[model samples]
Target chain A: MIETEHLQKKYGDLVAVKDLSFKVESGQIWGLLGPNAAGKTTTMRILTGFLPATSGKAAVAGYDVFEQAEEVKKEIGYLPETVPLYPEMTVEAYLSFVAEIKQVPKTRKKAAIDRAIEISGLAAVRKRLIKNISRGYRQRLGLAQALIHNPKVIILDEPTIGLDPAQIVEIRQLIKSLRGEHTVLLSTHILAEVTQVCDGVVIINEGQLMSAGRLDELTSAYREKDGVYLRLKKIDNEILNLFRQLPGIDGAAQEGEEIRLEWDRNTDRREEVIKFCLDKQLGLLEMRSLALTIEELYLRIVSGGVEQ
Target chain B: MKAIRSIIKKEVLSYFSSPIAYIVIFTFLLLSGFFFYSLVSWFNSVSVQLAQNPYYYQQININQMVFSPFFNNLSIVLLLMLPLLSMRLFSEEKKMGTEELLFTSPLSVTQIITGKYLACLLILLIMLVLSAIPAALTFIYGNPELVPFLLGYLGLFLLGAAFLGIGIFWSSITENQIVSAVLTFGTLLLFWVLSWVGYSAHGLWQSVLNYLSFFEHFDSLTKGIFDTTDLVYYLSFAFFGLFLTHSVIQSRRWR
Candidate 1:
């Protein structure tokens, strides 16, 4: 639904986005993950046709962003980094206005507004002024604004920036509900939101693309080479030495009662280790494959490598 | 059409929902009303004195006195007030970050500009209507010729609209509403008084400055002369102002 080809954007001496290339498959929930000033919002603005790239190309819904901005805009609904809203308007009025600007047909405008209000859980405050609403409601209103026309592609920039935990969960749940129905490209510094809601992530830092892939693939790819962690009831210097000598185990480290076993990637070591442990009558308390958290993975990806 | 209408509707609604619209309109009406009363009082004094003089040799044209002072005062009022109406059109959107919503929507830049320009023009239209209460009262008290009066009102509309276009352009280039308002005032004042500069110069320089003076062109219309040149000048000036505004807005996309 979205693609950028070596996209670059510069503000005089500062480059906001540089040689960014990524593709969001149709109906996929893609997270644009980066810390502050990572060009996430810049990339989104370019894709939404608000800002033209200094060089290269971007397309959303098969429409070129620069060449066919209006078509691209019609296909994508964007919620900017700040929830751009008319605070003086009531919730219902705001949504209705968004519907009109989004080109929802006059006949179905009411229905569209209702659906957005319903989806964003804004029914009770429908007639309340936006300025009087809480931050959570305002965030929901921003989501509703983006959803008013039911565009195929929805780009949300830092949608949950100032929300509480509950509100963040609600917003994440709302984004989850959009999966498979809309191509959602959302940017956030919150790794938790990305881990919980995004199917894939495009990680960037310093205006350059660092990594882009499925969440699982990227996480495991960046997972430390710890191999596996094990807590055994029966552990000693001799057993640790034995583990080091095992067929699949490349090395072993025992810290008192706990043990970390490193092994070759190709081997099925769990069953072998289990059989060996059974033969040796060793007490195996717990064994699990180790992986890095999304935060750690993102930090490593963004900090450790030169962007490709 | 629908896009522009949506923008216009949003803009007009915002204007009413906020106190700024009422404040601006009230101030304009109050000021225009005061000017109207003072002009009428002076005109009435002159007419009554002339009527008492049975041997008066010179004719006191009530129509000329009625329109010239009224419209001239109105032109100054519009020069002062129209900027307030146009100041918020683009500057507020920029300041509040709502320009993102406008620019990212399917609406083109032209739609946004035209919508805002139309909304500002509508506010100016309302101010004109409110200012006309004094003139409407004149019709009830005495007979005032309609054609020249109507033509004078048209001139005010054109002059106000052209100033609004300039104001819109100025507003687009800045995010501070007060700054936009003050700059608009300065620019319009320059054009309103540019003919004074023509007084010190000679030949082409004088004519050039005079031609650029909005007051010089509007004065003809106020005198009941509907020259195509004046009409074309205002229209083209307004058009060029909008064109520059479009360029400014469009250029921001690159930055």
Candidate 2:
């Protein structure tokens, strides 16, 4: 539904997006994960046909952003970083105006506005002026306007920024409900948001693509070794040595009260370790497999520890 | 066409929803009414004196004594007031970040510009119509030439359109409404004073400057002379302002 190839955008001597390439399949939720100033907003603006790229190409819904901007615009909905709204307009009036500009047919305009209002949970405050609404409702109204036209592709820049915890959860749930219906490309610096709401992620830093893939695939691909963490009571050097001497147990180290055991990727030594702990009279409190999380993966990629 | 209509509707609604439209219209009507009252009183006094002498009575035409100066004063009032109307057309969008909504939508820049221009023009039209209430009173008391009175209004509308064009262009180039209003006032004031400056020049310089001055073109129209040159000048000046607005907006997208 959305694709970009070597999409570079330069503001005079400063490069905002550098040769960035990514693709989003139909009906899939993909997160553009990056820190601030990572060119996420610039990429989105180019895709939405708001800004002309200095070089390269981007297409949304099979329409080239540069050559066929009107068509592309008709096929996509965009919510910019700051929700653009007229404070003087009522919520319903604002949505109606967006539907009109988005070219919703007159016969169905009312229905469209109602559906957007319903989806964004704006039914109660539809008649209230925008300036009088709270911040959370304003954000929802922004989303409602973007969804007013029911475009094939929806691009949101920092959709959850500046929201309270409850509002953030509500917005994430709203986005998750959109899965398999509309192809969503939302950018955010929050790692947990991507992990919770997106099927895949394209991580970038400093205007460069660091990594891109499904959540599980990325975690496994970045894993260096198979390991398990065990918390056992009454731990001692003698028992630690005995555990390290076991077959397939390549390394064992004590991290405070817990024991970290490393082994070959294909080995399952957890059972053996549990048995060993029982025999040694060390009370095993808890045991779990050690795997890289999306948070760690994001941190590793953004901190320049890994190159992809 | 539908897109332009929608934008126009929204612009008009926004103008009315705020206090700006009512304030501008009220102030314009009050000022124009005051001018009409003072001018008519002076004309009545002069005509009474001239009634004693047939020769002086011939010199006391109401069009020259009242309507011409009335139209000129309204033009200056428009010059001051039209900037307030156009200052927020584009600059407020930029300030409130609604330019993103406008630019990202399917509407072209031309459609957006036309919608806003016509909306402001509509307000100017409404003000002109209301100011005629006092002018219409002239018909009740004295016989004023109909053609020059209407032509004077045409000239004011054209002049207002030109001022709006310049104001919209300046609004497009900045995000600050005050800056847009000030720049528009400065540019319009320069054009208003150009003929005064031209009086000191000689030969070709004099003709060129006078021709370029908006006041010179407006002067002939209020005097009841209909010339295509003045029409073309105001229309082309308006077109030139809109053209510059288009270029500035389009260029900013690239930057």
Candidate 3:
């Protein structure tokens, strides 16, 4: 479990994170969605006890990050954006060192290291120097080090930044598997990753908390204007005008072969329009539902001046 | 204590895992060994021929050949080698982004600093121990005073520790290791020259300024005097540097 109350981090005249209050419950993947320079890393650093908040408080596993940072650290593992690693160290050596520093029990350190390596899919590169491995493997090594301690919470900042698509999927799946074992706070600018992996999404922008809710809630909330596309074989201009003049029809736009109709927010006029077309002896081919994506909602929240 | 030991062990292992420790120790032995043998041989030839002139030109032997030459050369060796050893103490972590990893771990700032300091001291100890071979060889041919040698080494180790602390603090303030090394070398050069500059001052002011010099106390150590004041002075210097390092790291968290 992790929580922040009005968390603020300011460096002189610049504010990096402001009033970011959120709680992450156990066995849930909480996605922190924000563009670059949106204070995601700053928030993660504060919660991980690497940086101090300018005001307010951060807590991890019931321990205050400021007052009891050591205890907080004991309960959490953090993978910074760059995935800090020693290039000269072998994967096993690096993980073992992380275990030692994380205070993993001596008797269980080996098992912990092996389990992390397996989870990160780094067993093949366990004996190689980190510098010799590819970037994807290095990222996995970073994840392995963080997970070696089996902390109650794991905070990953941009876990998949430079990897190719396949590696990204593998890492995403690895992170997905951690859902039930640890409370995960994953931050990224990638919208689709949140939809695929995270249970809840916390959208932030320009160092401000924008919105926080379930993934479906964000998508459904953004599904405000349900427009239907209709492709007809033949229709007279008078018939088109009459259909457009329907009381429920908010607006209409026509392409060469297809016509798109817009209704008042969430209003469905598809059935009426279809019946009208049938009554007028106009042929109909296709109809479908269009949903707004998380990206559109993110842009709306940031640009529409909706302050959270 | 466990955290401190873990950090210390990791730091030491990091040194051996690379070639840094070997390079530093090798260069230390090469430079100090060459200077030691060359000076002892030159002094041996002069002392043998000019037995009566030994006490006649007492200033020349003690100031040039015996004390000043060796201590000055040893200080230069330390000046060159310490930055190489200490420049990576915190700067590399800052550059690699591992400082976040270390700071966010369940270790106190004191534990981290002390571990790093102990690792640096261990490296200094290794260099000092190896340099002892040439110091012992000096006695094989000449009647060099063992006490002065011991005191000089103690002073050098303490001075190196203090320099390391300063270098580590400098490393913590920035992510540039080259800049850290240059700044450390520049500051140490200033400290090295301050004692000679103190020699030019007049009256009570000269004596007071001399007391402030790094080598003023160090010179007494190389003359076979184990002054407690010199020990306290070096200890304070090292402690102050370490304290400043701790403060810099803690302040960085807020910034």
Candidate 4:
């Protein structure tokens, strides 16, 4: 539903977004993962037709963003980083205004507002002025405004930046519920958010694309070797040295009573280690493979371990 | 058209929902009323003095002595007050980060500008209509020429429109309301004083300065003379201001 090719945006001498390219399929939740100043917001603004790319192309819902901005705008809902709102307006009135500006059909405007209010859990504060609402409520109101139009694509910039733990969980659940219905492209620096809510991720750093793929595919593709974590009842330096001296075992480190063993990919040294432990009467309590979490993968990619 | 209407409705609602609309209207009415009262009293005293001499009485006319200066005083009040009406038109949106919402919407820059311009015009219309209450009192007591009185109001509305145009343009260029208001007032004050400087200069400089001065065109309209030149001047001045605002906002997207 959204695509960009060689999309570059430069503010005078500074390039905010370099030759970046990514695609999001229909009804798929894709997270644009990057640290701050990684061109995430700039990319969203260009895709939403809010800013013109200095060079390259972007399209949303099969319409060229620059050539058919009005059509693209009508087909997408955008929530900026700051959640632009009028403090004087009531929540319902604000939503109604958004619906009108989004060009919702007059006959269905009320229904649309009600649905948004219901979805964002804003019914209780519907009549309250925006300035009087709490921060979490204001955040929900921002999401409600973006969803009020029921557009094909929803682009959110830092949707959960300043929320409490409970509010963050509620927002994450709300976004997860949007799966299979709306094509969501939300940007965030939080790695866990992507693992929890997104089907795929496009990670960028310093205004360049570092990696992009499904979560499982990215984890496996970036996994370089196999690691087995072994917890033994009686682990000592002699046992760790013997394990290190074993063939096919690349490295071994003893952690208190546990031994973490590393080997070449596609090798199983657990049998050899077990035999050696049995010969020495070392008690083997537990053994498990160490899988790389998204947090580690994100840190690796963002810290320049992998660049694309 | 619907987009423009939505913007206008929202802006008008915003104006009324806050204390801005009430304060501006009340202050405008009070100041205009004060000017009218003092101008009328001064006119009444002078007329009473001239009543004893038939020659002086023949030269005295209510429209000439009262409503013309009344419109001029109203223009000064508008010059001061219209900036307050327009300072927040685009500045508040920028300051509050709502410009992103507006720019990302399907509405064009022209539509947004026109809607806001028309909304401010509506408020100006209301202010003028209410100020007319004091002017209408003149009809009850004396026989004033109605055409000149109405023309004076036309001049004030045109002047206010021109001022709002400048104010909106300045608002678009800055995110600070105070800065916008000051820039608008400073620009309007320069235009206001241009006529005074024109009276002292000679030849080409004088005519050029006089022609460029908004006060000169507005002064002609206040005298009940509806020249197309003056009409075109006010309209074009307003159009030029809006055009500048459009260019500034459009260029911002590129930056």
Q: Which numbered prediction scores highest in TM-score against the true structure?
A: 2
| Candidate 3 residue spans exceeding 4 A from truth | A226-287, A305-308, B50-72, B138-146, B202-204
Candidate 2 i-RMS: 0.7
TM values, all candidates: 0.96, 0.97, 0.89, 0.95
Q: Is candidate 1 or candidate 3 better by TM-score?
A: 1
Candidate 4: lDDT over CA atoms? 0.92
Give per-residue CA lDDT, model 4, range B138-252, as digits (tens): 9999999888888889999999999999999999999999999999999999998998999999999999999989889988788888888988888899999999999999999
C-alpha lDDT score of every prediction, in listed order: 0.87, 0.93, 0.84, 0.92
CAPRI class of candidate 4? high
Candidate 3 lDDT over B94-183, as tens digits, reads 999998889888878888899998998998998988888767765776566666777788889988987887888888888998999999
Compare the candidates by DockQ and give the number of the best one: 2
True contacts kept of 2: 0.90
lDDT, model 1, position B121: 84
Error of 4 at A231 (Å): 3.2
Ranking, lDDT, top scorer first: 2, 4, 1, 3
Give the per-residue lDDT digits (tens) of candidate 4, residues A160-234: 999999999999999998888899999998889999999999998888999988888888777777788898887
What are the chain B TM-scores of all models?
Answer: 0.95, 0.98, 0.89, 0.97
TM-score of chain A of each: 0.95, 0.95, 0.89, 0.92
- Candidate 4 shows a clash count of 0
lDDT of 3 at A148: 89
Q: Score the docking of each candidate (DockQ).
A: 0.80, 0.89, 0.67, 0.81
lDDT of 3 by residue, A195-304 (tens): 88999988888788888888787777766677777788864576568767988887777766777777876577778988987887778877655566777778887676
Write down the lDDT that model 2 would get: 0.93
Residue B53 CA displacement from its true place in model 4, Å: 2.6
Question: Deviation in angstroms for A111 in model 2?
Answer: 0.6
